[model samples]
Target: MKKPQKAIVTFTNPTVKERLKPHLYSMMIKPWRMIKNTLMLTGAFVWLLLLLVCLYFYSVLSKVPDLEKVPFQHVREVAVESVQSKIESKTKLKEYQWVGIDNVNRDLLYAIVMSEDGQFFSHKGVNWDALISAIGENIKRRELSYGASTISQQVSKNVYMRSNSKSFSRKLSELFTTRELEKHLSKNEILELYLNVAEFGPDIYGVKHASKYYFGKSPADINAAEGAFLAIMLPSPRKYHYSIFQNKHLAPRHQRKLRRIFSDMLYKEYISPNQYQSYLKWNYFFN
Candidate 1:
């Protein structure tokens, strides 16, 4: 009788939904787990990349020479090693020249300050207004051709940066070093450093050397036109200077560019009307 009762036991079938509940939960949770893991990995990679960038920047900044040191303080016959290396590499000259700010003509100094940086004396390290305008100009042109570097920024680039350096990284380094320069050095000191490091001719470096190399005279004795001549060479010394110095002739295009720049210099009060007229007159003599 007990065996017969056991044979009558009923069988119950589970619903399809009930059977799929565990698998469905697993399917839903699987994608969430994968997404969470992917996000964690991406975060780790980003952090590592940022860390590498910081280390690289630190190494570059650490190598920068102290500004209060002997060579910088006393104004030696040659530029700092960083500057010297760049100049020598570019010019094929073994020496990096230097000159005192006192020895540089006011015309040359004013020309540089006005042409390169209109707010040299007023801005701290960066001329934000000029930089913003330059950025706008670059955006409009869709090219990074405009450099809104102040005297302090140029000095920092010459003294602490590589010649081949480019992009936003170069700008960031220049900004940091420029701020440091402005903190420790006066406007006059920054201008002095710029004059000593800037390339004025195809091979000429520093105001003193450029003066003697191109004009066969002292920088202190250069006329307004000569100063303007040197200022215009900054955009591309090789492009402009090779024609004037080697060919003994100024191109008509260069002359036109010079006239446009002179207008800006006059408006900025970098030169007087008389000086402007002198530069205009000097253009014909550039033959």
Candidate 2:
């Protein structure tokens, strides 16, 4: 009976901190955990994007052959828009020939460089100024009127793209391939390859074939006027070739364009005064 009476319990109130500690700690660290996870995700995404770009670059450049070792071809085939185009057009391919740099005259090279890209020798691949200007021009025109693609870019486009389709992906690939070309090949080599692959007429491809088809001479033997004519033909080869080959004379507008190219060549000191005079007076003719 005495032991039962002595049995008693004491009670104490708990503090606010002790009651709320676990919830408060979790609230404090929630934002930090979210931030850490977000950062990790962003980093992984960037790495994946870089890996895709590197793989694309390699894929674009892998198909190109070194001119110093193997000859490159301009694979030409006019896709006739017909139900039986493929079956009927078994041999729609045009002419293409690989010409070495040493076999081509320096004047022709200079003329092309002057007409296509004035800063061809200095710039690596892209010309920002001309490109910006072209972008502005195209925006104003509300059409893709201008392309400031360097000779290197043209080479990349002609070789890889195969068609004149101006898709955004094609342009991006051209940029990547142009840089790769600069890294792998010399300037002269790039020019040589371009001269060989560029479209000169509806059916003409490469300077070697172009020289013989248009002028009845080799590229090395082409004069300043002929070189300038060839340079101007680049923008619209089929459109420009309104000639005896196509059973029509050269358009007056094309002649004017050719003269303008000549003027540019002279102003840039790519040709002498006598050459300029000769370029102005010479008849724009092809064999």
Give the poorly placed runs of model 1, Cα more than 4 Å off. Answer: 1-10, 15-20, 63-71, 74-97, 128-146, 268-271, 283-287
Per-model TM-score, in order, reads 0.74, 0.66
Residue 23 of model 2, lDDT score: 89
Looking at candidate 2, the ten consecutive residues that score lowest on lDDT are: 77-86
* Candidate 1: residue 228 Cα off by (Å): 1.0
Candidate 2's residue-wise lDDT over 1-287, tens digit each?
A: 55566756877787998879988999989989999999999999999999999998677556554434333332222111111121222332433445688988878887788778889889998998998999999999999879988998987777665556777656776787687678767788788767866878766767777888778899999876788778777888877777523664656786787777778778878788888887787865433
lDDT of 1 by residue, 1-287 (tens): 45555556788898999999999999999999999999999999999999999998997677554566444464333345545655545544654456678988887887776667767888898989888999999999999988888878878777767664667777877788787778777788778888877887655778877777777788889876787778878878887677666776777876886677678778878788987887887742443
> Candidate 1 — worst ten consecutive residues by lDDT sum?
70-79
State the lDDT at 123 in candidate 1: 85
> Which is the leading candidate under lDDT?
1
The deviation in Å at residue 62 for candidate 2 is: 10
Model 1 CA lDDT for position 98: 65
What are the lDDT scores of the predictions, listed in order? 0.76, 0.73
In candidate 2, stretches whose alpha carbon ends up further than 4 angstroms from where it belongs are: 1-95, 243-252, 285-287
